[model samples]
Target: MCPPYFSSNTYFSNAIKITTFLAQSYTTMIRATFLSILVLFGVNLLAQNTPYPTRFELSGGTETPTYAEGIAYYQKLDADFKTIKLFTKGPTDSGKPLHLALFSKTRNFDLKKLRAEGKAIFFINNAIHPGEPDGVDASMMLLRDLALHPERYPALDSVVVAIIPFYNIGGALNRSSTSRVDQNGPKEHGFRGNARNYDLNRDFIKADTRNARSFAAIFQELDPDFFIDTHVSNGADYQHVMTFCYTQEDKLGGVLGEFHQKTVLPSLYAHMQAKGFPSTPYVNAWGQTPDKGWTQFPDWPRYSTGYAALFHTIGIMSETHMLKPYEQRVKATYALLEGSLKLLGEKRAQWLALRRQTKAAVATQTDFPITWKVNREKFSETEFLGYEAEYPLSKVSGLKRLQYNHDKPFRKIVPFYDHYEAENVVKKPRFYVIPQAWFNVIDLLKTNQIQMQTIKRDSSIEVTQYKIDNLQTSRNVYEGHFFHNNLEVKAEKQIMAFAAGDVLVPVDQWRNRYIVETLEPKAQDSFFRWNFFDAILQEKGGFSSYHFEEMAAKLLEKSPELRQKLEEKKRSDEKFAQSGDAQLNFIYENSIFAEKEYRRYPIYRVE
Candidate 1:
């Protein structure tokens, strides 16, 4: 039999014949089918029209769309295109829902099912810092082009593009012309902070904002193979319009990292160069010009690319130069996105295999690096096209200020300190036990889709515990946290009793790196450093000098070992011998009078 005709014009005739044969019994069913077909036909007709111009384009790249307008445009695309789908994933700090736009070749929106079918997922995050909206406009054009001209880009067949249209909705809504003082154009743009004035970029690991938690959910759900967080550069200017900060190779650490550094990154740079938009590594030159070499931006877990690296995803931050015209910046970002999508599509098989291998290796890996430092001895040379540095006196201050002489552009090879060595390494534990009291930490872990189990009943488990021996906290608040660093943790084997409902996170999983990095106290962006476990640093109880002095003497008399240690400390240190309170407090502390919870990191490790 011939296939049943569902075309709008043919559907009515076919439906009438069937209804007449069934004597009006099939009237309702035929009407419903006809209406559905008409709706679909209308959508197809709408899709054939000329693509809608974004606010950026309509304004000649002088302005970006408001949060509402950006969403409305995506909604329109969702209505018109069968391959495009828009989903409201979760809530943001702005009281608005976070929207994820998906463009699929098979029209399949299910990410897991698409992965099974061998389609690579490429996630593009835009407007994370609303002040830098290059990615915001570029992604809109990129996704729209993919939907309107699917055949023009054969990459769609093997790659699915997902985009977070406007990440910082609050900031996007809080638009102003004066927010980014350094930015060259875009007459108006969003602010840098969200509604709560939090920099969303640094909240990835801590997840202090609702937007971050929601992002965690979306990121874990997609588990993209290739990711890009778009932004505009804020540092020293150069001839290059676009620059990139890929996840540090040694930190990403594996065959996957090797493939990304040696194969994928070169292809992307070469592709962009061929397209007439020469690129360079992100100019991390702070307080200096590009003539001198600079180190790669170390993307610790707090940043977007760094978070993606924890999952073994190849991630890059496309940073367009802020001094460039808004139009040029947007176009450069668009070109980079196009090049990334094409490369990811072409190398999907090899990339996917590397990711799989990396994940498997992480699961069984023993030692994981928790901290990294740049290897200043090692560097790579790259052609840096930049303006000459000139220390011209400031007109207002009459003081010498470093400035780039844009009139004198030069091309010369500069050393790129792209190599990093692990400064602190940690042995992975079999499992990490988190007390129920630390609900916030546990919630974030769960949000990241880390496999966890709960203790059925109160039980004592022999585990390794960390005592926060020493650490320096930042005097100034950083991203709403008195961030801690220079950590010195002392590990000891002990029997810890965990109550019912306490979380047990295993290390033998795909999220091993994330588990280790966050749980290990020395990790640069660990929860302890973010002040999640700050309560442990303060002693809950203290001894009175007068009352404890007599008790200290008796305790010292009762314990010869304790007495000898106190005597040795006094002999070794003059200050200890002079301060009576210090002697009393030291004796009390070394005795059993001090609180066990004090200075004890709550997260326990199973070896």
Candidate 2:
């Protein structure tokens, strides 16, 4: 067995010096062979020594490390291990820097070089919601073990593991004991909201916070092949401790989606089951127990997994039940990470090939589904273990309230509605033109690495323009916006003039889905819905009723066609006939005096 002193920084520093001298003295081939032999020997010696315990292990898994402690531990590992590297990526809302810890067996940290060598990158994100800190602790232990015992994980040879030690640094810094009331263990945990009181998970697409923007920079840099975001579930009590939320396959679409649904998901479930941690689909059931049945949670582009899918990455969320012990949850999360790495290593070739093929196919694909709905007719039954739900009288309210009877556990077959069909589809355009005025939208597009170029000169091009016809907005605030939905748009061909600095985004690229979803006004999480184009939704100019009444009569007399349409509108719309202002306002709007920019979406599509 290796002595404890051999695992310290001094020992590794001396070892590096010896190896450097040998490499300088020997020939090229001899130096390569000698270095490989020395690396294997050093790793074996390190494996013999016990690894430094993680904060969770030290505390018996009842607590997680603080933001400072977690970063310090990773920094220590970065110093002691040759394969481990820690990088300061960008800033977060907490006024602290976000850190990325990478583990590569080949001692290579360059993502492009690894990709060129056919190595797959597996990314793990932790603590986006600090209340669910299972992944934070699990990742610390997992990475430590990987560094010490390289021989145990053959997958590291073909896969590079990149982990964001603490994603929401602000939330992690905001430690509390009373935030997650329903959670089982963990004596104390971080709050759910970050320093700015924003849920980081919901800010992926909008990127309203610095944390989300930093995540986008890291995500685009690695362009990982597989991704996992760890979380704790809050819902009805169930038998299983671990649950998973995979990116909706139909929304993922094409050969990549098929392979993920048919191959990757089943393998993960089986692997977890073999590891003695039986898992199920995320319990999306609300107002009822999961045994009754539940549909898969829809992960739109605002979510972590959903955002990853836009880049053709297979992403999953490992959600341990909130009712389970924190120790058990951490263990389950660790197992899932291990299983994912193994799967990535074994299927590296096929996964990479499929991703390439999918990107190639999407570049030329014409139609894309922007909206989706669950297909109840196409569901599969799975054996679910859940406790019986009962309505018991509440002592405080003196009314019946829902509660799960843990004593009455049962295993039964339940329908899992995993199939989703495209509710609305849109044809891909040759290019998307964005006027320079909407710089906020353009900035986010560039942040996500969507390729685009500025127009060389002012040009008038015939393009498809969308006029916002009808839409509904939430009466209450949600994520700092009046969320828009049920949108209707009318497209017309017009020769639109674009300025020299206007952005022209070509659709024939690997990020076509992202371009289509965000640029298309009707997509579920489009910028129009998120209020990026809210200025266009309101009319900047309006007619003065007293002055327009006389002008409206002159306009009506000048064009008989306008008069006929006004009469038809009055005959059909009783409200228009009853009000003098309405009649005059209608005429004023139809005249050339009305602003054409009103209710007109600025993004133009070239078909």
**TM-score for all predictions?**
0.91, 0.92
Task: Go through the candidates in order and give each one's C-alpha lDDT.
Answer: 0.87, 0.87
The sequence of per-residue lDDT tens digits that candidate 2 reaches over residues 86-188 is 9998899899989999999989998999989999999999999999999998899889878877788899999999999999999999998999999987888
- Where does candidate 2 stray beyond 4 Å? 1-50
Clashing residue pairs in candidate 1 (N, C-alpha, C atoms within 3 angstroms): none
Q: At residue 593, what lDDT does model 1 achieve?
A: 80
Clashing pairs in 2: none
Model 1 over residues 298-372: C-alpha lDDT tens digits? 998899999999999989999999989998899899889999999998999999988988888889999999999
- Measured over all alpha carbons after superposition, the RMSD of each candidate to the real structure, in angstroms, is 8.8, 7.8
